[model samples]
Target: MYQRRTAVRRRKSRLPSYAFVLAVVSFMLAFAFPPEQPDEPSARTLPVRSLSAAACSVPPPVSQGAEPSIPSSDGEDGWMLTLVNPWNPLPEDYACTLTRLSSGHSVDERCYPDLQAMMDACRAAGLKPVICSSYRSREKQEELFQNKVNRLIAQGYSQERAKAEAAKSVALPGTSEHQLGLAVDIVDLSNQNLDSTQETTAVQQWLMAHSWEYGFILRYPNDKSDLTGIIYEPWHYRYVGKDAAAEIYRQGLCLEEYLEQTA
Candidate 1:
């Protein structure tokens, strides 16, 4: 009987030891590690994977002139804006008002006059002036031009035709509006969804009501594609200075229309 009692006690002690071993094994397996641990804790897990070394990052969006998921925040994406005068593309030597580039996205430099005034006015109106795209270098244009050409070729266009089509969509080195340093691509300040539809923002109404006051004119319009040799672009606004903005708004003229009358 003593021997039998001794055996029961031994079995009970073994149960606790077995349970402790199982708990230790569970902890190691749960952590994907061995039983032995390093004195130091493992490095913290990082979930973000960045493609570049830039300190700042911009979200990925399709190239410009391509429709945003937002369905454009304005008419024809805001091409209905008034063109005050013929924006004789300003001289190249003009200094920019302020410049900010977007990293990991296509946005480059923010040019002066219009962007500066627009930003100030937006702030004053309690709006945020979000830059969509700014200045693109000649090299950048070439890259875009080449990409368009490639896409056209893939779509069965011959080299010459692809070149021609690309020309309409992609500006040559000196001909780009960006070269003038007065254009900016901005998003509506009130609502900030990357993919929000135009109906979701009031920028269109605000711009229509006040864009001319800031010396800005939507550079291209649905009514003037033939003259510009490009499709209507609503987000692009040119800074023609206040006088031109006034005349354009007053006469209900686009840049093309104003140019025709003056010419």
Candidate 2:
């Protein structure tokens, strides 16, 4: 009887110890191998669902100052923005002080410094930029216009047709920008011809890219010919002052477009 009772007591004691060991093993296993958690998103790996929602949302309104303000045309630099075209001829009272260049060409004295700096920069950059034509008297303009008309007539165009065609290529004497002394025909020394081919020259490429830095802009662009009322003459550049030039360049605007916006 005594042996049986001792055996029962020993069995009960082992039961409690066994339970304790089982609990400890479970705790240790939990610490060693924790349950998996969901992954967090990074900026680059944002959830697709969230991204879709964002993409569908309405865009924020543009700020008031988002677009650049057009410069004032009535400011002290008003003369720099003078508009000369077929319709707007040079005023009878218009006059500018002339500054002659080494090549016997002249530009407006007001724009001389910028013009000189532009040419200096071009030469410094290993370019051979030449001012082939600059300021022209009314008589010179008339002669050039007549020469164009004569050439067209020789090509079998009627006198009336030739006159109209010539005016398109060469501005009518009174309406020529050359008379204002703010425009110049710059050409690469390698190719002195004034045509679309000039756009391909190194000197022209440089001027097109950087002329605004020196207060000039390509006077006529190929696509803007309708608005400018002149064919694309890539060699021709006009002084509009640095402020207007920079804005015009940034906006991909021709001189007429820039003036219209400010007006």
Candidate 3:
């Protein structure tokens, strides 16, 4: 009986150690293989949704110091947003009512008032802005292109090379935005040169910063020439109506990109 009781005591003494080992083993197993978590949406998915929303949202109209309200898409004025480039040429019969400016340049009648207002504002700020070029008939554009090509050829470039070189600065007839009457080339009165260097002047800087307020945008910004299919032209501005201009300015997009994104 005493031996049996001693055996029972020994078994009781080992019980706590066995329980402890079992608990340790369970913890090690849990550490090795954890429970599966429920799948959740990833963070990367948010931007796509946000981008979709942005793409669909209508651009807000400009406020305070903004130009006139943009017309409805059904109106003739809607042509303000038309895209003209080497790839997208103007229609053969396209035309608009022309209004002559005091500068001897002409623009679409619809845009003339805004153009005058913008120039007036510049003059108020002591900047002498000059309109260097504006509306061009198809024949005029052809002449300009041929003149540039001839000049390049006279400089000893091959015919093919001359055409290519001239096209870099002057668009081929139907592709020239000047034919649209909504585009204008402006220069400081003291320096009428149209070059990339014009971007450095205070007048040009002012136009770049404030043109959107008057329903205008820089047509070929220095960084957007590749997309515009033209060289960087700091002096060129296009009237795209207030809302579109503001949106284009806000996004820093060329007209082609703006059209593509909205389309």
Candidate 4:
């Protein structure tokens, strides 16, 4: 008569096998799923798009951001606008050609150290540029502006219209680029003439196309009238340093836009 008694086994049953199973499960998860990234936000975070070209080729649409405060009337907006649309190279900060049309039209000797160098470059490059206009005081601008207003009025323009028209080319004293003595109008100096070819001449053309090399720019271009607030002056070149001019010309951005970003 044998009594059947069940004894519990105390021996460890395959500890390594349990560990191997856990390792397999971990490996499967590692292959099937990716670990979280540091840059990625948590579940509660709102997703954000990256700014790289792959994510957004163009800038986010404007007018969606908080609006800038409206500036006051006394050039408050003018400052914001001017800051937003700065006139680069401010006057005479950059070296450029200063031509003398008459006896009184010479640049201060210091303001023209590069004249000889510029002349040498022109001669070496076979560029014959004649100086057309030069330094004008604030009084001169007033005089010139009045003259333009008078002439326009004589041509059947209303007084208001004449004044506005004259304002374009003749800056209201102290605001003229020429006053800084760093601007000039150059053209083919052949026959010692002042008038440039309406289109850039071979000489002027080359100069305009490569003016940045000498720290100059065409000053005004048709495409940037709204920004420049001046008519295109293909012959006009203002010295703004080689790097700045190169950047300006290369980017094809107007002085206003150029100044804005820089400021």
In TM-score terms, candidate 3 sits at 0.71
**Model 1 lDDT on a 0 to 1 scale:** 0.51
lDDT of 3 by residue, 1-263 (tens): 00100000011113355587877876797699773333432222100101111221234344435433433332334467766777667766667778998768898887888888999999899999888899999999999999999999999999999988888899989888898888999988777888867998878989999999999999998887666778999999999888888988997888765654454
When sorted by lDDT, best at the front, the candidate numbers are 2, 3, 4, 1
Model 4 TM-score on a 0 to 1 scale:
0.57
Residue-pair clash count for candidate 4: 0
The number of the candidate with the highest lDDT is 2
User: Each prediction's TM-score against the native?
Assistant: 0.52, 0.73, 0.71, 0.57
lDDT of 4 at 40: 32
For model 3, the stretches where C-alpha displacement exceeds 4 angstroms are 1-77
**Which of 3 and 4 is ahead in TM-score?**
3
Compared with the true structure, all predictions reach lDDT values of 0.51, 0.76, 0.74, 0.53
Higher-scoring candidate on lDDT, 1 or 2: 2
Total backbone collisions for each predicted model: 3, 0, 0, 0
N/CA/C clash count, model 3: 0
lDDT, candidate 4, 82-167, per-residue tens: 11011222232223234553435655233355544665677688767676766666567568779989999999999988877766
Candidate 1 stretches greater than 4 Å from native: 1-114, 123-128, 189-201
> Which residue window of length 10 is worst by lDDT in model 1?
1-10
